[model samples]
Target: MTTPRKVTSLDVAKRAGVSRSAVSRVFTPGASVSDRTATKVREAANALGYRPNVLARAMLTGKSKIIGLVVAYLDNHFYPTVLELLSEALEREGYHVLVFMAAHTAHDIEDVVGQILDYQVDGLVLASVALSSDLANRCRASGVPVVLFNRKLEAEGELAVVSDNRSGGRMAADHLVSLGRTRIGHIAGWDGASTQRDREAGFVEGLHAAGLGMFAREVGDFRLPRAKAAARRMFDTSDRPDAVFVANDYMAFGVMDVLRAELGLRVPEDVAVVGFDDVPSAAWPAYDLTTIRQDAEAMVTITVSSLLAEIGGSNVTPPDPLPVRLVRRGTA
Candidate 1:
């Protein structure tokens, strides 16, 4: 069968007994058109099954109504939730999300971002990835609004939305210490992530304030296998910690699994555990992990609002970091 002919605005205008310009105005957002005329145009377009060409319209209006989202990985439970929230928020604002998964390397990010730019997205949100200085400068020069979500760049003049990781770290340390856990250890996330650095610093500071020090530390690189290996090394030692804090829930789950299944240790009894990013799994019957909540709702709301403002030329300065809270549960 042959494809049906495409319907055009002129056909709708003719059928609605109005000028083509009137139909164009009716289809364009924020364009001046009377309610009666818009209704007529809509009825005519429906009858003819005429859909406006979005690309052509974007060319005319100089706005794609598209937001590019760059994420390195979605395996982490926290990031998938954040991505869903961002998509919902952007949709509510009449924008579409174009997601790009970049590789771990800086060059990969730069290439992917360059491809995103080719689509002329209205704005960009970088999640859990940092852009190179050259790419950042290119984005700035292009005048496209760029916002970092759950990540921060050392370069000045870039917008970011993140949880107060330092405070969360301190809160975790304080809770473990309050339980009289003198030999407290830490399982850190990826070394290069800003979240990892801040959390570690705050935990160290909290331990010092309590007149104690870290009994042991290991890098998990935000992976489950590495975290399990770290747990094994820590627990197999003669000076095994009485308590431990894992940087995020993903790694926390691994540490907990090893403690219970492999090491035959009970949580909060043999080894009290605290984690970050109070992900949904943390509250499961299996883990029930006490953790620092990153306020996903608040983080997503601020990120969308900030990115929209930058896109609309209303705000340029980045907002302050949002606060985190300790969520009490069975663990620790």
Candidate 2:
């Protein structure tokens, strides 16, 4: 039986009337190849079905060009928005994203990360995750560049692309104070996560700066029902706050639902409310939530670019605290 001939670089070089060395140099990056010869080699290679093995090329260059994208709690809109930007930005940089969803717990990542590391990813972007400092240290020690997105590392010298959480919290406080609302309370995110902790601290400091005392706060774990429970507690108590700032818009929406449906309270009039993240629903006519807007798209873009740069051998360090802004609406 006659078998089809296996195409090789020599065949391509012969067909293109160029030396095999020229064909090899044309495929290899930073290798000297004339423009006239490169065109001929590409055309010949295309006709001969001689596609280069990307894995082998990457191994030769000591770069995998695969990005590990770790997203915890994608149930929140913020993570999904960040993920969409990350996928697009990474793709544009000739890198593929190996996505992993960490179920809402630091413990869950222990098992999931094994797979991400197995993919031989060039770099990693942790999307609002609360990785333990020890695990993060191990990741760094293993020679993978890790960049945190929308979250900060507790330890020093760790790379991160994080929003100005303290500033965002202060912004929320300033807006509430401007409305002449006192007795401000906070509905915070997960207690262990850096974003939640920093936002809570910033809000507290901001209220202090405005000459107001923080009445009380409850942890929502960045969830709806938990936020509702916290808000319900505030409503049920005899001594309750007049206005509240809930960290993240999803929780804020939950707080609003409780205020309107369960407690029958009017927003801004009865209990002025604010939230963080400023998710798409924040600007909707129904919610119209006055919240701190963390530019999810921009954050994702910068993080992806930084990670790709590191993967491609660029010695780039991401900004310590990424920028966040205020998106004022009607809740407060």
Candidate 3:
């Protein structure tokens, strides 16, 4: 038996009694086509069961209409929301998202990014994952535009969109101080992450501005288990913190669980708690966590617009940091 030949646009144009360019315009987004001509093209396409070859179209136009997204981890509640917003925003622009998960090791990141490049994506978005300078240089040399979402790389010529985490940290500190927390401590996230450093710095600045200093500090590494362990050490000490500001809501949940379930400490009574990233779980009755809201929708919108601007041959300046707000709740 012989395989069937694929349907072509020319065949549809002949069947519809229209020019081949009319059929092309009907399938091409943003291309001009009359309503009657589009209707006739669609009917002919449906009757002939014809579909445009996207790969061939991409080869001809030098555009894949695909954006590559690299993410380090999705366990955090924040990133899942970011992914959803990105997908929706890109779809509206007639683009699709291709996700790539980079491992912890540099070698793994290089390898995975190389595979993404193989797909010839029109642009790339890195979410909380930094590419090595060498890999970044390679991407630049290849002429593919990249935008960093919720993180920043130290390399030049890279665009980033992030919340004003420093201000959020200051807000958290001021809120705790207003609550009359004398002995305040903090559970920091990963040491190397830029977000962690900025938040910690702002927290310290806010504390000093209020004539107070951090009582104790622990590294959570943005992991629940590590946060729990850090909470144990802090609470077990004789001078436990009267208030604790966790780096992110995921770690905050672990810290709260350790304080309430494991140590039988009453939240906001024994120790007030605050967190960053007003994740959905933060609003639950059990947690009701006071947190800094990082507007995911705004971040996603800016990121997509910046990326598309670059892809459209426009030089994009780094966007100003998005604002964050403190969402007051029962915890603090």
Error of 2 at 63 (Å): 2.9
Q: After superposition, how far is residue 165 of candidate 1 from its true place, in Å?
A: 0.8
Per-residue lDDT tens digits for candidate 2, residues 1-332, read 99988888889989999898898789876788889999999999999999766566676676667888888877787777777778888788667788888864667776777678877778888777777778887887778888887777667766787788988888888888888888899988888778888888888888999888898888788988899999988777778888999989999999999999988889988898989887887888989998888887777777877776666568885476767888878877
For 19-60, candidate 1 gives per-residue lDDT tens digits of 999998998888999999999999999999999987688778
lDDT of 3 at 109: 74
> Which pairs clash in model 2?
162-322
Candidates 2 and 3 compared: the better one by lDDT is 3
Ranking by lDDT: 3, 1, 2
Worst 10 residues of 1 by lDDT: 312-321
* Model 3 worst lDDT run, 10 consecutive residues: 102-111
**Could you tell which candidate, 1 or 2, scores higher by TM-score?**
1
lDDT to native, each model: 0.90, 0.82, 0.90
Give the candidate order by descending TM-score: 1, 3, 2
Could you tell me how far off, in angstroms, the CA of residue 122 lies in candidate 1 after the best superposition?
A: 0.8
Q: Candidate 1: misplaced stretches above 4 Å?
A: 17-19
TM-score: model 2 vs. ground truth: 0.82
Better of 1 and 3 by TM-score: 1
